[model samples]
Target: MSDNLARQFLLREDVVFLNHGSFGACPRPVFEAYQGWQLELEREPVEFLGRRLHDLLRAPREALAAELGCGSEDIVGVLNATTGLNIVARSLDLKPGDQILTTDHEYSALEKTWAYVCRKTGAEIVVVKVPMPLTSEAAFTDAIIAGMTERTRVLFLSHITSPTALLFPIENAIAEARRRGIWSVIDGAHTPGHIKLDLEGIGADFYSGNCHKWMMTPKGSAFLHARPEVQGLLDPLVISHGWTAESKAPGAKGAFGNSPFIDEIEIQGTRDPAPWLTVPAAIQFRKDNDWWGVAAHCHALAQDTARQLGELTGLAPLSSPEFCAPQMVAMPIPECDPLVVHTTLFERYGIEIPVFRWQDRCIARLSVQGYNSRPQMDRLIDALSELLELGAPQIAAQG
Candidate 1:
């Protein structure tokens, strides 16, 4: 069944891809839709961009909003989650001594973004070290709530972390942040199609996610969602024709006749809107294929593979099964050079996976999509066993 689904994707035939979490693989149908949008744009550039663009863009936003359980007016398309997050990070009226509280498990790019923001505004970054082998929601939420102080102005967290691939139980934390009047920003870079989401239920002030990673859209597609009340606070990272003096006034519409949030963030000049436009096709593809069932199978396969790797390496996993992302697992490995492990796996075994060092731990993160099969997983396990020199003898020696 999985093998049948694999044929729909455009990944290389030879390589075993276990890195879908890094950048998602789009199905042929969705890619075709992306190309069609580009062709339409090129054939009549002014007609497409000038006259039909606002309405054309509206459909995808509405589609995505329905999936996320939010109002279409609340979200605007961006190039990626990083771009959306940077807009939020840079827009805040942060002052000196204001602190941005976040976890150590955040993506490195956003970390640099906040660092830059802090440097410019004299705001401090407060990182909470989430306890390892994360077992309970109470422990996770407690650690986050405890870290917040009077000076904390923003509470940022990853819905599903980049490095660890752990699905943080952040609902309680976000609620707590809301009660305390701190802005909550979620890096949901891994969430969109990987897990079920209800953005309104989650109640985050600012949430951003990538359609490219899990929704199977083209690389540049992503979005930032802001609650209606806070929508007025953000300034466009790039001020374009969308900017209007009336947009600053309460109850005033944007230059493009959309909400100020949508017009300001999405109307940046002269860029390919193909990826963003392809989102509906991707969403429809998922619906037609029963992707929820495929996701369940992939999750089981990923966790089983992670267990196999843990047994071979005699190392513990980063989190319990419930806390781990549905289709991605960051399996801990023995002390070794992550670069060499990554290179050897790709060069020698035809397996493509991300092996990286995150703080004190070396991890090989595996992402299983519908296209991946048990045979491919077996190949990954065999490759890791050989490369890490792990076998029955090694297990006995360690024992």
Candidate 2:
């Protein structure tokens, strides 16, 4: 809300950054905490990794679980949301006639991941096209529910869409999946810090979120949560010590002596657990500064900017304000080369935002964080007004 908050982040002062949805900017205090963990790891690699690693991760995992409204056993830290979802996608037992139903608004990488899994397992991917200029939550839920069939095995959906920047009301969909005895996998990469999340209330079988994106943790800090009943169905992406322990003896268990899910996923060979360990610090940073207040301020700025952009281009917004993200909005830009528009905004105006083609239309998405102010929005609006003239003749005449 304050320009002073911008100085606490590691972002550069010379450029206007409106792409926090892609990769988030971490604050100075959180980064210092991350580095401290790394330093501790380096000082005693064997003692840290071999001895105290489990104990070290316990507190942060508990803290994150408390924040997410889930049990400590339900979640384990991972690199990112994609990695967490990959574990679920790769572990499913898909038959030739089985189908995975999802919307077209999913992230591109996960789209490829599902495609590859289906190709290998002989499963079908039923992609439902969610109508643009979204009317209401009931309509969106109905669109997804229509894609279900007798053979539909899994229902996948994003909590907040990557390109469209729309927040799908997934509670009804997840409840429907439960009623139909289907596995519900939620990709919540953009939800954790941007909006309120209650994993227990949502009741999704599997959910993955990125702390690095919205929670302001260092890169590679993310989490995967699975219901206790479904935990046994998932196999770790990498077969590690936990897997070996289970394989050697039918009833053999790891140090946890409880569920094998956390042990298997959390103890993937010795790498830096520092990123995962700093999650509490990131959560604390948000609490230290009233994050809900910051989110409200950023949402107002984003909505105002999108409204101005739509007025300038004479194009309506993709989704209603209630359905959009708190800090991010996708504005429909005039007909133009998306690549040229993206490059010119960065190279010429020092404004960093994403302008790309989503299906047949070009959209410029703006992301406003706690550090962003009204001046940054005005700068983007001015730069866009000048550059968009190249695509629209009327704008040039007005200028």
TM-score of 2: 0.96
> What digit string (tens of lDDT, one per residue) describes model 1 on residues 1-399?
456799999999989998999999999999999999999999999999988887798988999999999999999999999999999999999999999999999999999999999999999999999998899999999999999999999999999999999999999999999999999999999999999999999999999999999999999999999999999999999999778988879898888899888988888898899999999999999999999999999999999999988888899888889999999999998777787788778988899999988998888999999999999999998888876785334433432
Stretches of candidate 2 exceeding 4 Å from the true structure: 245-252, 255-258, 391-399
Local accuracy by lDDT, each model: 0.93, 0.89
- Give Cα distance to truth, residue 50, candidate 2, Å: 1.1
Every model: Cα RMSD to truth: 2.7, 2.6
Give the least accurate 10-residue stretch of model 2, judged by summed lDDT: 390-399
- Model 2, span 96-159: residue lDDT tens: 9899999989999999999999989999999999977886999999998998988999999999
Model 1 lDDT, full chain set: 0.93
